[model samples]
Structures are given as structure tokens and as C-alpha cells.
Target: MSKLLNWFKQLDENLVKILLIGFIFFVPLWPKLPLKMVDYTYIAVRFDDIYLAILAFIFLIQLLRKKVLLNKKFILPFFVFLVAIFASFLWNAYITKLIRLPHLGLLHSLRRVEYMIMFFIASSVIKTKKDFFQVISYFFISVLIVILYSLGQKFLNFPAVQTMNPEYAKGYILYLTPDARISATFGGHYDLAIYLVLAIPMILSFYFAKVRSFYLYLFIGALLILLYTSSRSSFIAYFVATVAFLLFTRKFKFLIFVLILTAGLMFTTGEITKRFLKTFQVRRILIDDRTGAVYIGQTITTKELPAGSFYVKLKDQSKGDNLDTFRNQVVLERTREATISGEISTLVEEKKYMASLSANLRPVNTVVSDISLATRLQVEWPRAIDAFKKNPLLGTGPSSLTEATDGDYFRWLGELGLLGTIAFLNILFLILKTIWVGVNKLSFSEKLIGYGFIFGFFALFINASYIDAFEASKVAYTFWTLAGLYIGYYGLKYEKA
Candidate 1:
């Protein structure tokens, strides 16, 4: 352990700077970064996971130069996870007779491997306090660029700037309000929202780090951007981070200040407050039959009357609980309409209709619910589970889930089988447990920082129930880096004193 620590302490600062520079490439790829360049590519049969591949090469060169030493001290389990996942992919390809998976598809097969390399860089390279602060500082500086550019896109109507694409410009710049929500340079609103959610915590950490007053202002500015995006997952992420931070610190005074400051901000920014309040309205619309049904059915502007019935089904006798009652009413009303119009009839008909209704309703519900309850668990999870059941040992290939199954868990089973899934699950449980234990050992301020990342991970995990954030390049990179930080901070048993 001392040898490992000493080796880590000798890591060259210049090499560390190169790794930080590599981080810059990723931000432009974020949807609506006001740039138009496809950040990754494939040549012939070879695929490049731009960020990961680049980082891996840099790390390798650094090791070769002896600027940093590569020792597999804390990386065994991560390696196992990578090997198991890749082996499963090869097994899936052999069984499924895919002829050839897309070159890019096969490229992502290295994602976990790339992530493990990042963990090594983070764990070994970030030894001294200066090295640690530099990493954190680089992160905030990059965030500043993101915030500034996103603001430029939102306010100045910055023409789309991309290295590869020019026609991708969005004219208006409001990021949080749903109608004309800006993607800046990203793929869409959701993409920008996801990046912002993950970055927000790190930005907040810098804000409280006592670096400068401008950081506090930047934090406020970022919060405004979040409000404008009106992304429920991001909002929930903020809430989760806040609650976890507070609970961990047990700082009542800070908690009260936060609540009061929040209320004050809501009072001051009528537009933002209106929109924040509007999310609850969205929740209301989701559950209400008359408004929600039209919204879900895409009949909000349809001149043609819907062929089916529209009404309510109160599942329970409960009152004063608006959302559940509204959902029940919608089900009942829709069922009655279906029966009256002969679209469907009887309890079986109602069940079928609701199930059909969910195909459309579920996406919105999932988006609001972080895609866990309505979509991931309800639809995709079952499908994935079935796929896993069929191939219990060496399941399916990477990206096979989108093609063959729907649930991530099932994707694990289909690609890796029950064996791979169990292995993956064990790794996940270990990481979460490690982070949780680390959180318990931190100073109050450090605990807040740790808690923020933990909340971000949980938020993404919940969001993954519907969408594939884990598979997404930007989210995936951020997750693994933070995971690495967590391991380094806690797993090393490095005493601050």
C-alpha cells in the first residue's frame, strides 16, 4: 500500500494536465453546446470511443514515460466487470448470428474497459492535495465555459457553431421552459438536461469551496438555467442532492437558510417560480383525465374527434388527493368512452385499453418519474427479464437490449446471462456500498461533496429505468469519473490528519 501511495505521489503534473485537457473534448459533444461537430467516429472496421480511447492512449503513454506508474491495486473488481461484460458481448454475437454488429456498436464494447482506465488515472494520478484541487478546479472551469455558452445560446441566439454541422442552429434561447427549450449544441433538451444535472453538483461544490464570490454567482446562474430547462429529472436531482447533503451534515441552520433562500428566490423570480410551480401542474395534467388524456393522446390540437371514449375511473374512494383521483377518473372516463363508442368493453376491455393507453402515456410518466416506475419497471424491465431467462449463462451482446430486449437488467441477462448479471450487480452493490461508507467518514464539507455525487448517481440510476443514460457517452464518462473519485477518497484509507 505504501509503495502504491508513493508511486501515485510521484505522478507528473503535466500528464495530469493532459488528462484534464482531454475532458474538454467531451463538453462540445454535449447537445447544444452551441457547436456542430459529431465528436466521435468509426473508420473502416475500427471504432473510436473518442473520449475513452483518447484518455486510454494518454494514460498508456504517461505510463510508458514513467510519468505515472500503472499498478492494479484497487482496480481488480472493475477489471472483472469489464471482462465479464465484454466476454458476454462476444458470446451474444456468436449465438445471435448477427452477421456483424455495427462497428460503432462493437466499439462501445470497450466502455467499461475505458471507464476502468479512467479509474486508474483518477486513483493514481490524483495523489497530492494540489493534484486533487487541480482536477476539481479544471472541472469548475470547464463548467464555467458550459454555463457561459449555454447562456449565450439562450440569450444572444448564438448561431449554431459546430466543427462539422452548421444547420443545427436553434433560434431561441430559453432552456428550461418546455416550448422553445434550447438544446444549444446538444442532441436535444433531454441531453442538455442530463449533463447539466450531473455538472450542477460539482459546480455547487466549488461554490461552497470558498474559492471566489463569482462561483456563487455562477452557481445561481446555473440554477436559473436548470429552472429554464424545466427538466423534472434534473429538478429531482437537485432536490435529492440537497436533502442528502442536509441529512448527512445534520446542519439545521444551513438547511433553514437553504429553504428560506429557495423561498426567497421563488418569490423574486416570478417567471421561474411560475415554471417551477408548473412542474406540479404537469404532474396534475399527467393524472387528470380530461386534460391529461388529450395531452397523452396527442389530441390537444386535433380537430378530428378521438374515435374512442374519454372519461374517468376512480380506482379508490380517496378524496383531496388530486393526482390519484385524477388518474382513476381518467381510467374510468376513458373506459366508459371506449365502451360507449365500442372501442372496447368489459373489465378485460378496460385493462387492454389502459395498457394501450400506457404505450403513449408511459413515456411522459417515465420522464416525470425518472422513467423508473412507468417505463423501466413496467415495460422494458419485464422484456429484459424474459431475455435473460432464455440465456441465463452467456446472455446477449452490448446494445443487444435495444435490438432484442428493453430492460437494462434484461440486457445484462441477455448479453451476460444470469452469471454476468450477478457479477454486474455485485459490482454495483459494492460501489454504492463503498460510496455510502465513504460518506460516513468525511468532514461536514467533504460529506456534502460526496453526497452530491451520490445523489447524482441515484438520480441517473432512477432515470435509467426509462432511458439509457448509462450507455450514453457523456453521462457514462461523468459517472465513472465520479465513481473513481469516490473510490480514491474512501477506498484508500487515506487519513486527512
Candidate 2:
């Protein structure tokens, strides 16, 4: 027994750290029993139970050994960021009237604590290159399983395990498509796709870890699953990530390979290319028929507009009158303007006029819809900002984004105020700045892996413009884990380097 204990003691700390990384990633899978919390949106598996059980096991074993706690130089930025979060939480508890207080969104404050624990484990536990590679290997393996499951759902029509289970949805990635999305085995296709995008870089990180050529097959397989998903957003994100990765790593050979692939796609996808080119010809080409359909679609023929609607109504005095009078008025007005401008020759043609109007209006409708969704953030953000302007020291409160502003920035401002925003931004800049510093120190293989992590991060930031990615659980987890790995690598090795 002493010999066995000695054997365990002689094992490197880096290996244990790597195991801890695996434990954290795979912990989500262990919480099979779902408990629906009052404040949370869905049934959450009790991760706290699993975490406590693991911690107990670790603590019992550590009774026989000494533990080393590595002090990270970058800890200040992380602490500052956390302080800002608490400050914001407190501020919101005070200012917001309609919202509940005392327990004032304390659930989320606890969730932030959960995140901090994960970050602490990652930053402190991981201490060597061996640990980094081991963590990366597990990431690749975990994602490979996810990829296979998603592909099976997409192609083999694999049945969901929980049949007639209302709480559970179908497939690995459920709700894959309007017809059928490629979910593999995830709860939703979008989630699966997003997860895959995040994993690709981590897998590539193993390139310098002395992995076998078969790992390349795994990478290609993951890419295939992503393609099967046919998620346009994911596709765009992947392409952008690849380009950024190549550029940042200065992988000229890979860049040339991409150029060749682009050329091949242009050559092979003739029909698709034709359709792509046709979009640019929208102005030049107009089918002679469908003028009536085009006109009706273009003209705003009003029925009873919804109350408090943003829609503008003019000449709505007579209920008896159809939209025909307005249509005629529009036509007459256009004809008169054309006559005055000496475009009467062109006005003689009905086809040209209708086409122009329809083309113009189609874009307007699209723009209007886009703006309406975007305006939710725009409107809520200013209010949050105004709140910050009122009290710039302490923030509004925790989860103030949902209460005070629909936006990430404004929510930070409203909850934490200006002081908090600066602190939060400092944390963000610190992470990026550290990554920049690390990238310079890496070899070709390390740089390749780092490129994926960096590019994935860059993609997330771009996506943040459209969606509050940092606010979502899945996206936030992915972002922080990568950030943790990057920081952990540098923190543990800062002295050695």
C-alpha cells in the first residue's frame, strides 16, 4: 500500500491537472437527473451535487499529499472583473423599483460564482505543457463523440433515445431544421453546430502534441458534420475563423491550400456559382409577367393596423374605398414626374416601372424587419446607459441587462455603471493581451493550436454584435474555457519561460 501511495505521489502534477480539465468538461454529462429551479429557464441537472462529490473525493486523496497553489500574475484583472460584477448586482438591487430585491436575482450571482470556481480550477490546477496537451486531447475526444452523434442523426436518421418524452426533444441536435437540421446528438442543431465551431480549434491545438495522423481524420469528420448542419451562420463563422487562423499563424502553405480549394469550388460548383452571380444581376433582369403580384406585394394596402403599431396610415378616412385609389394616385404621381423629367418614353413601359418599385420595396421590407429586431438592443441599451450616467460608481445590480438593458454593454453599465465597465473591459483586454504575448512564444505547432483558439475567440466577438453571446450559458462556457486554457498555460509557465 505504501509502494502504491509512493507511485501515486511520484506522478506529475501536470497529469493531475489534465485529468481535472477532463473532469470539468465531462461533468455536465454526469448530472442525468434534471431539477427544475424556480428562477432558471429550464430543468437543470444538479451539477452542484456532482461537483461536491468530486471535491470530496479529491480532498480525501489530498490528505496524503501536499498541494501547490500557483499564484497567477494576471489574477488582478480577473478579480477586478468579478468586483465589477458584484458592484453591478448591488446597484441594480437599489435602483430598479418593479424588479424583486433582497433576493434580487441572487440566483445569477450564484451562477457567476460557479463560473469563478471553474476559472479558479483551470488557472490554478494546470501548471505545465503536459497538462495543456492532455486537456486539449480530452477536448478533441469529447468533441469527436459529439460530431459522430450529430452526423448519425443527420444521415442515418438515428432515433432519439427518449421516445414520447415531452421534456426531452428529439435527436442529438434537436430542432435541426425546418425540414431536418443536422443535430447529431445535441439538444438542438444550432447548439451542436456552435459547439463544433468552438471545438475545431482545440482539436487543432493537438497538432503539436504528437498526435497520430488519424486525428486529421477526426478533424475532417467534424468539419463534415458541420457541413451537414448546413447552418449558414456556422458556415460563415468557420470560414472567417479559418482565414483568421491562417493569417495569424502565418501559415503560408495552408493559405495556398485554401486558395486552391477556393478555385476548385468555383470550378466544380458551376451551377451554384451561376445562382450566386445571378443575385448581382437583380437590377438588370426582370421577368415580364407577375407585374400584378409584384405591385400588390410592393404597395402597403392597409387593413386595420394593430393598435400602437409603428405603421403609418394616411388617407384612411373612407372604409368603403379600396386600396385601388391610392394605387392609382401613386401611379399618376410617378407618371407625372416621369413626364416632367422627359422619362415619358420609359414611362410608356409598365414592366420597367413595376420592376423598379418592387426591387426598391423588397429591400426596404428586409431592412425594416432587421432593424426591428436590432432595435430591442438599441432601445434598452440607452436606458441602461442613462442609468449609468446617473450613478457611475456602483452598478445597478446583477442580471441588470435583462432588467435594465437588453444589451450586454448597457447592462454592464446599468448594473455596474462606468466603474464596472472599465473593470470588465480591463479583464477582456488582459485576456487578449496575454494571448498576444503567448502567441509570440509558441512554436509552429503551438501557434497552429493557438491560432484556432484565437480565431474562435475572434469569431465569438463578431457574433456578439448580433447576439449577446457572453450572456448565453453555452456560449459563455465555451469562451471562458478557452480563455482559461490560454491563461493557465501562461500562468504556470511564466517563471519557467
Candidate 3:
């Protein structure tokens, strides 16, 4: 077919520009179909890596023939950053070995360079606004598929391929009860949510630019998915990116629309919030008798309470009252109000535990009582800080930390140290600078490309504060490739001019 011939043309490495566009569509959403090794280490080669490798090999041969050139601005900083990545990696490896500390191996450390290479290839390949536009089409087409699958996954229990966790085993699909947050084709809900945080803002820009109504619908779908994720940090990131995009593009009316939509969603959101809020509230107060599970609705003196239970005096309440007593009273009052409001059936299982800290489980800092937040602050951050202090120039190597590096910036500081940190920042500075330059020169419809690059990147950056989103495979690959397209488009345009 003629379409097949055209596809061949697009895949041809001699036409590097077109081939890179093809890579954009195929790579990011490729299922994590990993190669199982006999040694028990899984080799997960992403499509981005495969296609880019092919592109590199083809371009290398062309380089010998003097048919193509890899050129771009920010070359100096980019290589320096690469060097920093390796140097910090090697330094940490040496230090960790000398100090007998943990470190991420060579493969994990060097793998980032592979992600960055697409930026260079993209910069080399794209020669016009048309090229960038075509590439954007490739990207969103893949996204639309992901969106459709994610929404579909909500109703129909589709089989998924995930190696990330035991919950997401080879034969399993990740599920949650009542309202299961959909992970779709991605590895997890957090991954899907962060990807949307970067993507939704970029897609929404098309609506304001009068590009098409289709993208607007896509944006709405993405927003629905984002809410379904229930990731608070991602919500904050998307909010920041949305505001930043509107302000930069000077589109205030849509901002108002977003605010109204958020208010609407808040009213309509069901059991998810109730269940989430309940985690912070006290539930049942046991009288130390497993058999005495009945609710008497009796007001007894503090002296009559169970021996093992906690008691604390409050400023407003009677002196002998405790947190459990306070919780029980609140629940009873609320229950009576709810009965008056509408009705909730009884005869459920007897409430067993209350979350409020009593005198027995008194924390050093009462205010920092959130268990999740407390763990991050008390355990992860301190461990990272100590790692950084040990080798301040370049901290412990990648994977050196004992647990997940939930905070990306700190991970860089702890793993790579100052040299790596500066390099990484410089890399971002250059990418942003390229996008900044490209935006001014674009036509109205085409300008969304630049807007997408700018705002989506900020969203990812914001997400990086709480998660290592930049290192996330899908986010990293697509981001670099888009930035590369922008840079390449800019270079081609300037050269002709």
C-alpha cells in the first residue's frame, strides 16, 4: 500500500527528521515487555531505547559518509551535565565501596544518558514547524489511546503487564476496591497521574489557541483521569502548571472555567474523600474486651475507662476527658445529625480502633502526627541528608539510598552532590531556553507546541518535588524528545533564514 511505502519513508534513517517523529509515537507507551535473564535480572528495554539505538546506528554510518550533522545550542552545558552524571556516579561508587555504603549500579546510573540522547537526535532531525506539528500528532495519538484504555480499565477488568510490584505481577492487573484508581497501561496510579500532570496542560493549550475541539475533549478526559487518581501532589502540580500556562499565554477566562470545574468536581466526588478523611479521624474505642463489641451510647466517667486506653485533658472539654472519649462524642453527635439529615443503616461490624494519639503513644512532636508525612520527615529525608553530608561533593551513588527517593531534588543532592545538581539544573536551563526561543517565532496554532513544552515541563518539575518524575521512563523520554524537536525546528529555521 502507498501508506506502507510512506511508513517506510518515515522509518528511513537517511531522513532522520521524519524517523524521529515516528519514534515519538511508538516509544513512550510501549508496554514494558522485558527480557527475562537466567540470572534473574530483568532487562526492560523500552521502545524509545530500541528505536533510538537504531537511529543512532544509522546516523553513525551517515556521519562517516558526511551526510548529516548533530548540532544544537547548549551543547557545552549538556555534555558537562552528562559528565557530571558519570562523575558523580563513579565517585559515589568509589566512595560507597570505600565507606561500604549502598549505591545504584552502573547500568541505572548510565541509563539516563540514553534518555537525553533523543534530545540531540530530535534537535538534529526536525527542520520546520511542520515537523514539530507532525511529531506532536504522533505524541497525542498515543496519549489518546492511553486515555481511552485508562477510562476503559475503570469498567472492564483488563489484563495488564506490570513488573513493578508483587501486586502488579505478570498475570495480574492492579486493582483497588470500592473506587479503584485506574493505572491503565502504565505501571501505577502515581505514574499515570504525573504523566497527566505534564500532559493535560499542554493539550489544554490547543483549546485556547483555537487549534481544535478534539484536544479540548481529550483534556477533559485527562482531567477526569487525574481526579480518579486521587494523587494530591499531582493535583497540586497540575494546578500550578495550569495557572502558569494561563498566565504566560494570558488566558484568564479559561482559568475561571477551571476554577468552576474544580468546585463542581468537589461537590460530586463520592466515597473517596470520605474514606480518605476517615483515616485522620478516630473510629472505635475498645474497652479492652474483644467480646464487648456493642455500642452502648453511654456517657461514662473517665475513671471507668479501660486501663490500657489513652487519656488527655483538653482546653475546652472536662479535665479527665481523653482523645478517644472526644472522638466517640463527636461520632455520636455527627451520627445523630446524619440521622436527622437523612439515614445510615446500622448493624455493621463494631468499630475497633481510634487514630488519635493518647498519652501512651505520645510523639516527640505532636503536630507532626501524620504517619505517612512523619515517616518521610523522620526517616527518608534524614537518611538522605546524612548521605549528602558524608560525601558533600558527590553523595552516595544512585540506588545508594535504602528506600525510594520520593523527593527527586534531594535524591540528586544525596546521590550526585553539588556537581551533579548544578549540571542537572543547567540541562533544564538549556531546554527551557530552547523552548523560550522557539515560542516567539511560532505561528498561532504552532505556538501551542512551545506552550506545551514550557508548561508541561513546569508541571513535571513541580512533580519532581515529591516524586522522581523526571526519572520516570515515560515522562523523561517524551519530554526530552519534544524538547529536541523544538530545538531542531529552531535550528533548521535559523539556518534557512
Q: Choose the strongest candidate by lDDT.
A: 3
Write the residue-wise lDDT of candidate 3 on 32-122 in tens digits.
5543321222335555567778877776676566555676366788788777767766765675572233223565666677788777777
Give all candidates' CA lDDT scores: 0.55, 0.53, 0.65
How many Å off is the CA of 447 in candidate 2?
Answer: 3.6
In order of appearance, the predictions have TM-scores of 0.66, 0.66, 0.76
Model 2, backbone clash pairs (residues 3+ apart or across chains), number = 20
CA RMSD (A), model 2: 11.4
Better of 1 and 3 by TM-score: 3
RMSD of each: 9.8, 11.4, 10.3
lDDT of 2 by residue, 126-173 (tens): 557876666756766667666666666656676432211335522122
Q: Which stretches of candidate 3 lie over 4 Å from their true place?
A: 1-22, 37-52, 62-68, 95-104, 163-178, 266-371, 441-448, 491-497
* Model 1 alpha-carbon drift over 4 Å, by segment: 1-13, 24-48, 98-105, 159-178, 205-212, 260-382, 392-394, 403-418, 428-448, 489-497
Model with the higher lDDT, candidate 2 or 3: 3
> Per lDDT, what order, best first?
3, 1, 2
**Reference-based lDDT, residue 156, model 1:** 76
Q: Pick the candidate with the highest TM-score.
A: 3
- State the TM-score for model 3: 0.76
